[model samples]
Target chain A: MKSSRGLRLGTTLFSFTNEFHARQYSTEQLILKVAELGLGPGLEIVGFQSFRDYPEISDKFAEDLKELLSSCKLEPSCLAINADINIGKDRTLTVDELVVYHEAQIRAAAKLGFPVARCQFAAGPEVIRRLVPLAERLNVKLGLEIHAPEAVDSPLVLSYREMYVKVNSPYLGFIPDFGASAKALPPSFLAHFRKEGVPEKIVCVAEEVWATAEGNFGARLSEYHRRARQTGAAEADIHKLNMLFAMLSKQKPSAWIEIMPQVVHVHGKFYEFDKDGNEAAISYAELLPVFRDGGYKGFISSEWEGTAFTDDNGFEAVQAHHALCRRILARA
Target chain B: MLQTKLIAENGLRATSTGFDVEVRLPWYRGLPLSTVEIGDVVLNGEAINPASVSIEVNGKTRLPGDLATLYDERWYVLDSAMLHVSHSELKRGEQYDVAVSVNLRPPYIPGLTWAVKDAKRLTANS
Candidate 1:
């Protein structure tokens, strides 16, 4: 039997993708602290404005990181490829240029004891085709992220999978973000809740929120708290109060693992933990059993999202999640 | 902190000694990307974009001055100093505009990458 080799619970510096002022936590702090916390299943390293500069990844920095992780015994989770594709200057990437970017990531990952390098907006399958040979040469996963507003059945899936089948390559794959699948929900889908006909004011803020931004309300429980001061309802237990109602409202478990085999690492996301240290919104009782059944075995790092921790308790929250996720994955 | 966007909607190509500048609408204008030409020299560029203004990135400062001569059109890129624009000027909220200059690169390369020589916070203003 292929036992689940899941590596659980690590942090993404939290502030990196979530905001622009990401330097509140330094690279050294994020790395050394994760090791200090003993949350070293693997560390997702951001090689951009937070730690390094553009066009070039730092060689000296990479060597220092290698020494740190080796002493601390942490494997690299992944490397986020930075693309400042905004407006004003040129932001498009040629395949060759992308290879150069990928080369930097590959070299960084190898030095830090990683076989997979994760990229954000991976253009298309042709880019993957070009990257597979490079990844084969370097031995890495040139990952494209399947995000929300796009599903497993979407055209993007067809492209990635078709490239895999046609080229029959293993170097190219995907990082199936659970948050994206969690985003696939209907507007009128919340009517079937057990706590139905309750106060509309409870989930009122959340409802207004999912309407404008990304639709996957289950993954975005934290965003509600951000706008709550403006909504005249910002207070304790505000976001989770809305989330508990939202989770119970789901009619089905949802098709989350459709892009799994391609996934190298997971953003082990959760909002609540029970007396026994289990997630509240998600049914791991059912989900872990599913992974066991499907032979799904790999890295699962906890990304404790939600506003409960704040800046002061970020470390505490991460430690708690690290312990809880370790316990869960140990059972598997 | 100020930004401007232009597109070379038809096509743009420049020589070591000569360059042309044109402004066109963006792809949102239902024009083609092939028509959009951004000027880029590997490490730097000199743009006589307008009649009297000259913008030059000689691998250091984004120096803007009065237009002088033919060197106005020729771009200079040092061995490792590539010049690129990180984004376009999405004026207000609309998403289209055309620009001209040999300074434009096709979304592949960044304009300028730099390191601070001696960066520190001032205790107080001089």
Candidate 2:
């Protein structure tokens, strides 16, 4: 099963957010560590969140950043940008205003040497349509992230696929976060809830409800509420159960094949990498093959998210994830 | 995502006229005080005047009435400053819905702002 398409491994700076915020590691240290660990050459960064003075970098700063990446042997993969509709408490940005805000980020991404700019879920089709022209002119692709709770068949996702098909432009596409393809609830999440005093029975009931629930999100949520009430769940516990619906999706890995062509970037979202160099929850063993077989030539950025749930070192977790991905891809 | 850290327990202390709370820079990197603006402060559904707020950072207290420069550091700390808010009403031991509205003007792109409107629970101290 030799592949013809390029499938380069990458790491998103977000994986190290906790470390960065804790002052344990700087962006330069993270980039150098990525290179030092041989964790692929590609790098994805959250524009404003990662840089010290993002959305405001001077030419000198931009040049210095590019040189830093070059010296560390890392290539810019994508810039994750925010599409904030609410700029104030009582004020929401108009569609026109949103276009301006997104365009500024797009320009910044291009200036920072990234080929793609990853937009959040809030960047609807209309906003993306408005951004397409600017993206094309700047030669940077705009990828709408398909994160958890957002199934591949979700209306918003479908709408973006339709728009992409109609426009048939490379400037607009999707960045599929592997969290949507999770097979089971991440153990770290369940542990977190348990530590917070959520009873194990209640957690099990929530997992069962999630696994067997059907129909639209609203209907499924109502069913979960009903089930929780039947179990005599407390008000606070019921509320915690509701959060499960927002964190995990029931989509199979095969579902991605339908929209594989539009996937310009990949967020290899994982919670824990076990001693065997395998993810404890997500079935990467099942998902990476689909991407490999689908001929996904783009970068799959390792996005370790366990830092929020546990005190584990993000640097080591990301390194382990890269190893796991390499083994899977090698087998394919 | 807007990052926030609570500096003290029951961080909001009720005053005769208003309330006072302390906050640090949301991130490890220090931002220019001139580029920072505290637009509105809300407690328990009541909105406090943004004008009555003064920021204390780096041992120098300055009221950013019109974007005055303060703090020469290049990065933000966990206990950066205190926000003195003037409100006519506040009670003790009651949980208040606290929301802080802040806007940062990062230099790379002008007219593009990062606004943070996050809510946290604060028990008002008498």
Each candidate's iRMS in angstroms? 13.9, 7.9
Residues A206-267 of candidate 1 have per-residue lDDT tens digits of 55665444434344455666665565653643533453424322312235455556666665
Q: Write the per-residue lDDT of candidate 2 for residues A179-242, one digit (tens) a residue.
A: 8887777777888879868877778877887778877567777877887778786977777656
- State the DockQ, from 0 to 1, for candidate 1: 0.03
lDDT of each: 0.45, 0.74
> Which 10-residue span in candidate 1 chain B carries the lowest summed lDDT?
B117-126
For every model in order, the fraction of real contacts preserved is 0.02, 0.02
Candidate 2 residue runs with Cα over 4 Å from true position: A1-5, B1-5, B8-126
Enumerate residue pairs that collide in model 2: A55-B108, A55-B109, A56-B107, A56-B108, A57-B108, B18-B87, B29-B75, B29-B76, B30-B75, B30-B76
Which runs in model 1 stand beyond 4 Å of their true positions? A1-9, A14-25, A83-91, A183-258, A271-289, A305-312, A330-332, B1-126
- Give one clash count per candidate, in the order shown: 28, 10
